[model samples]
Target: MPLPRPLAPTGRVAVVAPASAPLDPADAHAGLSVLRERGLRVETADPAGGPAAYLAGTDDARVAALNAALARDDLDALVCVRGGYGVLRILDRVDYAAARAHPKLVVGYSDVTALHLALWKEAGLPGVSGPMVASDWGVGLDAETEADFWRVVGGDAGYDVRGPGGEALTPLAPGEAEGVLLGGNLALVTALLGTPFLPDLTGAILFVEDVGEAPYRIDGMLARLRLAGVLGRLGGLVFGMFTGADVAPGRPTFSVDEVLAHYAPSVGGPVASGLVYGHVPRKSTLPVGVRARLTCGAEARLHVLDPVAA
Candidate 1:
């Protein structure tokens, strides 16, 4: 199946909340302002601001808002407001059929990883594993992250992403792997292992990252992937920024390096070193199911192999 094409900057963008509680109007406005400055027109549906506990709204309500947006011929794409716990609650409730038939650039990370995987599995349309409208852009994505977002959205043919200026990549395995890039939050990817939404990783470079998870927790999650045969199936692996800010006040019992080494061999493929994407500021954007080339040795590099939709 062909990947979903990205919308041009002037196209109308739909802001919705498949997850997260309610959004603060102030934050939403700030984010939309940034998009507007970039030449995009963003509009919100009624449920975009509605609240139902920790979700934007009720399962049915959220689904309705999303479906309504997807059904619109005028909306060029949908951008999630935030990624919280509730998206999984309404995972099955989305009308992916119409949306897939009329592919739109769906964006978000973290909880939104669920949506990304679903869209790829059910619709065969690739979506951005990037920032959400409310948090990423509003909270101030570092200059690098902001640039990476436009690069992916503009469908830059292929490009390389390096670690932040002085930051160094910690190599896990030495070599290179080329194939479609697939994966998001380590926790989310592991959570869906036995589920239907998990993508086929036969020859894909898997990338994962997360926020607030303890190193031990990261270890456990990677272990689950190994047990579920996820690691063993990848063509390669890319470890993203595991934000330590969310870890409790104590020293981590395990380091990310240890966790990567433990599972690197199980993947039966090359494992690229540290990648600066995920729960950190200035995160790099990646299309969940797009193809890419990952080289790891003395230095590390991720070269997108497939063209992002334009």
Candidate 2:
């Protein structure tokens, strides 16, 4: 897939909620302010008003909002307001044709992973697996996170993704591999399995992360990936922050690290952990479907080999 046009300094960005509504309206407003401060023209969709339980709105409303943004040639990018749930429910109804035609940057993570994977597979469109309005910008980004986000989106030259203090990721298995960067929230990626939306990850540098899932659950998901031959087809594998993976008191279970260790040997190439991308405040904004290289050893590094944006 070709890279989408980079966000111009004065680019027009449309903010829409395609998943769950914001937990706090104030946070959403604050996030929008951050975008304005960057000198970008920010447009927002009306709240898809409806009592649809956990969803931002009814399936039809969310789909309409997302599709409208995808079809707008005036927009340089579509920024998701937040990601909780609902994307999976409407993946089939998405406007893939408009996405292929417009090919604007679609930015968000978590539940937004479903949209990213679907857009990539169905329309050959690349996207930023980065922060969302209510999720990151609303609370304020750490210096590293803010810098990395703009650097990738602004069409800056290729660079290495490092920890907050320039530390290397922990090496799991020793080796080197290069492939397009793909994968996101573990649960979302796993859910897309057996679906047409899951991209062909053969030789792709797959990275995954999750929050609030137990070690056993993580083990099950990784097992499924291995059983489905997903792990064996990867050029490399990266484990990001698996936050909130602690087991309950008195529960007998393996540690998250142990679970990962059990599956590392099944990967086709190098493996690494501690990638600073996940549900945390500080993260490296990664571009999905972009070529990248990963080296797993004492001097481990993940390098973006292709420009994320044109």
Candidate 3:
């Protein structure tokens, strides 16, 4: 595995919109300001054209901008502006050669998960599955979230995964396992099933999270993974926040917790929840493809075992 160079305090970062354009341009500007305030040089990659519907630009333009950023020798990192949609459409066209040749930290989540998985599969490059420029920084990150992001990308050796309030994770199954940390948004991970982009996650510590998915949908997705032999091959399993997945009042439905419990037995090893990651303001910056250890019992603990950056 190739770890990108750790970003320095004064490193240059390219901001690109590989998914959706910022709903408000002010958010983009504010996000850029945040980077500048951090004493980093920030540059925005302007695609050939303007937004095409919901996407930042046409597929060709978005891919071109992303490839250009990847090929840049000066940039220390590339951060997506936001994650709405469109990355899946241009996955095949991404310049994986550029990615391998110039491995740099790419940061984003949600729709960006597809890109992260594809890069890892095609280029053996690791990435920070953390906050987006416009989506998080523009809105302002909580202290913990901001600290976690910098700690990972800045080449911290390792750290314990803690909730926003510094609470320990809740244990779902009693055991321990260690492996490379993989996975991102639940929906995106599920969508990549059976695709060439989805990496072989055998013996890997998979962490997943999502927003707005109902309990039944969560159950179905888990079922699909179980049926596909995904859950059975895991070294361990961790669940982040499942936002907006609560059961409606007076409705017949299992809670997200119930759905997860139903599938806990399918995992090959330890199981845990409340990882303090996902589509939330206060989320951890996880380095995809890095080795990590998960311990679950009375107290759940996730310890990243490798520096994300060289």
lDDT of each: 0.77, 0.89, 0.90
> Which structure is stronger by lDDT: 1 or 2?
2
Models ranked on TM-score? 3, 2, 1
RMSD, one per candidate, in order: 2.3, 1.3, 1.1
Of the candidates numbered 2 and 3, which has the greater TM-score value?
3
Residue pairs whose backbone atoms clash in candidate 3: none
TM-score for every candidate vs. truth?
0.92, 0.96, 0.97
Q: Against the true structure, candidate 2 has what lDDT?
A: 0.89
Name the lDDT value of residue 34 in candidate 3.
Answer: 91
Instruction: State the lDDT at 297 in candidate 3.
Output: 79
The positional error of residue 309 in candidate 2, measured at the CA in angstroms, is 1.1
- Please provide, for model 1 over 1-310, each residue's C-alpha lDDT reduced to its tens digit, 9 standing for 90 to 100: 5455666778788888888743576777788788888788988864744687777887888888888887776766788888877777776777878777777778888888888887788777788888888787776677767777777876775777665453445667777889888888888888787777777878889888888887788888988888877787788898888886244566656576777788888887778666878877666788777778877787777788776575
* Model 3 Cα lDDT, one tens digit per residue, 96-202: 99999999999999999999999999998999999888889998988878888888899886688887678688889888999989989999999999788999989
In model 2, pairs of residues that clash are: none
* Candidate 3 C-alpha error for residue 35, in Å: 0.8
